[model samples]
Target: LVALPHANAQTDPLPSWNEGAAKKSITDFVARVTTQGGTDFVPVPERIATFDNDGTLWTEQPFYFQLAFAFDRVKATAPRHPEWKTTQPFKALLDNDMKGLAAAGEKGLLQIVAVTHAGMTTEEFARTVLDWTSTARHPRFHRPYTELVYQPMLELLTYLRANGFKTFVVSGGGVEFMRPWMEKVYGIPPEQVVGSSGVVKFQIGASGKPELMKLPKIEFVDDGSGKPVGINRFIGRRPIFAFGNSDGDLQMLQWTAAGEGARFAGLVHHTDAEREYAYDRSSKFGKLDKAWDEAVKRGWLVVDMKQDWKTVFPFEK
Candidate 1:
């Protein structure tokens, strides 16, 4: 009788990834770092991996998913705050005028975020995020936003974790926004999820119980240069691996690559317009221009969504 391949040997750690350079790079790096006595071997304590949330892990076309939630929150609370009807950015959003909203600019967008994401108890905010993620559907896919996460990415996260890597999401999105459902969705607990955050204050509720109330004031903006700062402040260790998908993540990637020893830095290049959105330099959200150039220059592994991923979303058959 002919010998067959072992059952474990036939199992693919990243089934959603196509057999190509991107997949090979990931597997090879993991193998090198995990192998005992190897020069590239990294200790379990130092096996930290950082990932970006928006375009790197999920779809971020048209706008960010957090921004979509903010817009929905504005609509839901509009009746109570009728003043929003006459307000510039809020009015533009209510009127569904993309041009007017764009004209309002970054400051206006921050205003929206401030209103929608704050002025509530931390528990209440988390509950609100959980509810929204459960019910809210993406406009294009008609599936829940959480379900829009890339299948290959999910596999990669799991594979990394299985190999003694501690993965953390260091994203530009709000920390509270991601922490609510990160454990359920990504197997990463809230504590491991770090992102941009607003200020909060301790207060006593009507029931005399203490609560942390979310404030409109920004505390930390964990994007671009802020990423390395946040990582240093919160994680307290230089990550051995980092993966991201925009100019916002350039600094984080740089920080990871700058660390001594064998490090892995990668980017997800959105190149599939057929299955997903295709964008790079000119996209309003998650622009991959500077980071793309940097990845090319530094010889970082850039996973082409069109060519490297066998599947885009988890819902895809």
Candidate 2:
């Protein structure tokens, strides 16, 4: 990894990325789009790039951060409910027992998210996420979860932005869920994050602050078809590059690489089982079955996690 120049009017674009096939592809694409001499240059500077948040940027092993947040929320709130001590998943979470909750599966996780996430205002929820992310440490890694983010990916984000690429996190995870701390963690601003979101309505509080309420119903679940839809609605432009780790991102990658002119699409495979939990076609969190097949079929770069990545997380200790 190289020390990159800050984003400025004349920063030599995409300096953070390495000098390899990946770097060459990215550099060439940007050059084609911006350089006057390059053939088939896109006149407009609309290089939208989408990335999946979980498993792509950070370690998503034990489970997703949002899920862990929801579980913690249940633990914090379960005492107030009292009856939760007798409930199935709620009781499991209240006891700080994730294995029991796992026995209940994804439905159980959703229940935890709904009860803890649905009633609060979106702003409150966002603040809560920020608060939690700041303090919470990953269980196995024993580092702040934010610190567990892939260093190479961070480099790639900077590289893209340097090349005049507008990056968006098009994730299956919640939008209000991620936008809170992503700016600090990923250098991605809140507006650029497009993800699954609960319906948010503006409400004027007694303090006269305009607050956004988080409705129980989901306004969007930005996975599968929703990823493309979110991109169309939020970006209004087809992406030139897409990066993802799972089958959930197949459509997003497809849409970007299929577009006209030079495009880049790649998948990050989790192969380092010792450093991080390895799961691909068989695993639960970010399953890679369809994407693995499609990546090969489409000639998309399949990044072998251990080989392509020089480092996994940002924590030095």
What is the RMSD, in Å, between candidate 2 and the native fold over all Cα? 3.8
lDDT of 2 by residue, 1-317 (tens): 66445444245443333446765665676677777667756655567889998999987887888887887777666668999999988888777676898798878877777887787787678778888887877898877778888887887898778767788899999888888778988899989999997777788977898877787776788998788888999989998889999989998988888898878888888988876777898887899999889989988888777655656666642
For model 2, name the residue pairs that clash. Answer: none
Q: For model 1, how does the per-residue alpha-carbon lDDT over 1-317 read when each residue is reduced to its tens digit? A: 75455653358888789899999999999999999999999999999999999999989977899999999999889999999899989999999999999999999999999999899999999999999999999998898999989999999999999999999999999999999898988999989999999999999998999999999999999999999999999899999999999999999999999999999999999999999999989998899898889899999999999999999988886
Q: Which residue ranges in model 2 land beyond 4 Å of their true spot?
A: 1-20, 97-99, 206-210
Q: Which 10 consecutive residues of model 1 have the lowest summed lDDT?
A: 1-10
Question: How many residue-pair clashes does candidate 1 contain?
Answer: 0
Leading candidate by lDDT: 1
Report model 1's TM-score to 2 decimal places: 0.96
Top candidate by TM-score: 1
The residue ranges of model 1 lying beyond 4 angstroms of the native Cα positions read 1-10
